[model samples]
Target: MNAFEEEREMMLRVQQADFVVVELTLYTDTHPEDAEALGQWREAIKEAAHVRRQYEKRYGPLSLLSVPTEQAIELGWRWNSTPWPWQR
Candidate 1:
């Protein structure tokens, strides 16, 4: 495969993984009742966490949603400066 193909494949994998983790997150958010689901849910969460850690270790810092990175601009006197939505 070419570089574009390889990059596209990686992106698709990341997207699919994020979708699975998102479903698990929604379940965990309302993780009150349903003991059986809770057990299965915990396993899912654990698996997702492992996958995420592996991805991050291979790549750089990343969010679960795969949001594009917003970089910080540093200026000594200016203190704090950040990326705007348009910049992103």
Candidate 2:
């Protein structure tokens, strides 16, 4: 696959992990002391972050918060050329 396709796939993976974490977070709010849920949430968060970093390294930044200094310096206004992560 091309770089764009690969990047989209990685972004999808990260999105899935983040969704799982959010779901687990809501469950933990009710359960409070569910060790298993908490552990799964932590794992999901870690996996999401790792995939995010990988995406950033391979394909520019994913969001304003995760923007790398090099990307800012190198790409400047070119980021607008690409579609947003949530967009088709």
- Candidate with top lDDT is 2
Cα deviation at 35, candidate 1, in Å, is: 1.1
C-alpha lDDT of all candidate models, in order = 0.52, 0.78
Write down the lDDT that model 2 would get.
Answer: 0.78
- TM-score of each model, in listed order: 0.45, 0.76
The sequence of per-residue lDDT tens digits that candidate 2 reaches over residues 1-88 is 9866877798888888889889999999999899999998888889888877877776667777886547667767355776655563
* Positional deviation of residue 61's Cα in model 2 after best superposition, in angstroms: 1.2
How close to the true structure is residue 72 of candidate 2, measured as C-alpha lDDT?
66
Positional deviation of residue 8's Cα in model 2 after best superposition, in angstroms: 2.0
User: Mind giving the per-residue lDDT tens digits that candidate 1 earns over 1-85?
Assistant: 9755654455556566667767866876787586877776777667666655554444423542433322211212221333221
